[model samples]
Target: MRIGINLLNLSQDRFGGVEQYITNLIGHMADSGENLTLFLFLKRKLKNVFPQHEKIKTIRFRKVMDSADVYDAIKKCKLDLWFCPLHRSYLPSVPVPTVATIHDVLHTEYPDFVPGGLEENNRYYGQYTASFDAVITVSDFSKSTIARQLSIPEKKIHVIPLNAPAIFDQAPAKITMKGVKQKYQLPDSYAIYPSSYNPHKNHLNLLKAILILREKYNTTIPLVLTGYADKSNGVYQSVLQFIRERSLEKQVWVLGYVPPEEMPSLYWNSSFLVFPSLYEGFGIPLVEAFKTKTPIVCSNKGSIPEITDHAALYFNPENPKEIALKMMELLNPLTRKQLSEKSSLRSRHFSWKKTASETLKVFRSVTRN
Candidate 1:
């Protein structure tokens, strides 16, 4: 079967979840010999590394394609279906079946989390949920919420849990901790929180939890925060203010937008990982932590429990005191090792191969329809 994909947003330097999903899925499908021909649609000049297969050919669109041109490509290419990995314009130009992945409903449910999202993103949520043929969500939480929000049939929405790529299962890089420390200027004995300052990630709560441990108790271990931070968001502003108010500028290391390559070491070298998201369709960091054999202190919200099981020390995401208590539990050696072993045990349940096999089933069913 021939498949056309919207790869315009793809990049090799992605620190976001959608980019990882697209890049790894294409690579795995290419290597799996599914007898599928892929035609990619991209508009940007970003660096791309698609699989080299006779079956796969990239069709780069010009800076813009008119409505007529988009339809022309759809019919002219004779694509069996068009797959938009991220949310694309919900209205498809051609009659071919359309499938799109909706990672999180945060933008719809919690508009405060996004920049002008309360006013701007509703149309996207409305379009994709109503217009798409089949909706693929990253978790059951999203499937249920999106179904209600869009008033779409539950059967039309499918829940496909995400998986860590082979990179997570691979051995650590040759770089030493000393080198990573110098490269990122990271300190020894630090706790790592790799999520961004996005409000839904509950960065404000995490910051408050860390401050409780440091300021209230004078715990000296530094907290390493790796994510993009813009001051406009309430969470970002609060985090910045907390650091200044508590005089925690030195205790907090905010490495805004670290590259994807260094993520593994950052997870492994950390004393423990903290992911107290107020909301997540699927917390990608929990799986990454489990794969890296890193201990996690994650929130009980969303699919964290479904994914992490008993592997993590759960905390109430809203109460900063609760997150602090969980964080304190990690400092105990007995609890630390227990969580470490359980994390690795739970991680074995998820894999890209498994994800691809299941996803391909959905693709096959959709094409037949």
Candidate 2:
């Protein structure tokens, strides 16, 4: 089977989840020993992102390749299937069956976070998805949302869960952890939230919960945040403003965009994971915590509950008090130990190899039709 993967939408370290998803999926697929020939279509600058494999071929284009160029490339590949791992493809029409992974319908579900609101969300996510032969999503929640919001049949949208990056599985050496701790100026004991500064990530409410912990409970829980933060992002700016206004400078440490290699150390050293996001198609950090045997205290919203299942202590994301209470609960040694055990056990349920195998099934099924 010949499969073409569209990786043009990704840039190095920019798209956290989608980028991880594609790279992991391809890695597993190439190593799966299946009778498959994979063609990767990406910008020339990103050619080195995926390692060389006998089953994989790279088709690079200039950074400025437009829609026509993309379409022409797909046509020339003459693939049995074309897989767009992120939402939609640039090609208007392709020579082969198409499958797209629409991670979430967050734009339509929460237009407030999206710029230009519903009109813009619809323009990007609404009509374009319908053109694909099949849609892939990370969770049942996302599958349903994509179906209802986009008016695509539920049967057409496949639910394939995601796993944490393989890097999280290996325990970081004590010396390495010491180095990461010193490099980031990490607290001796702190909660970690690894998410980009998107409004839907709800960093503001998490900060409020931290403040509540200090004022109401008289408990000061240090927090270490990891993900992209930039001056240009209004949401990140708002998070900074909230931290300043609440005097949470001491309690909160923003270690923006920690490298993938250093993440395991952060997880190993953290007291527990705190995820107060308002939305997620699939919470990768939850699994990361599970893989590291780190307890989780997270929001009971979107696909979070589905992904985390009983491994985490759930709290309403909109209620800072509830979030604070959960955080407080997780601080107990017994509670943390118990959840950590569950976290370890639950980590067994997901793997990149499984994701790749199921995805290959999707490719074969689509191509057969």
Model 2 lDDT, residue 155, Cα: 81
Q: What's the TM-score of every candidate structure?
A: 0.91, 0.96
Q: Let me know the TM-score candidate 2 reaches against the reference structure.
A: 0.96
Tens digits of per-residue lDDT, candidate 1, 1-369, equal 778887665554535777767777777766666878778776657544666777777776666546666667778888888888865544544478777887766766787666557446766565455556787788878888878766778898888778775667864765754567779777867789887666678777777887788768766667888876656856677888878987888888888787666778888888899888878888778889889888988889877777788888899999998998889888888888988898889888877776766666777788883
Q: How many pairs of residues collide in each model?
A: 0, 1
lDDT of 2 at 62: 80
Which stretches of model 2 miss by more than 4 angstroms?
13-15, 63-66, 123-126
Residue 137 Cα positional deviation in candidate 2, in Å, after optimal superposition? 0.8
For candidate 2, list the clashing residue pairs, or say none. 227-257
Residue-level lDDT for 49 in candidate 1: 65
Question: TM-score of model 1 relative to the true fold?
Answer: 0.91
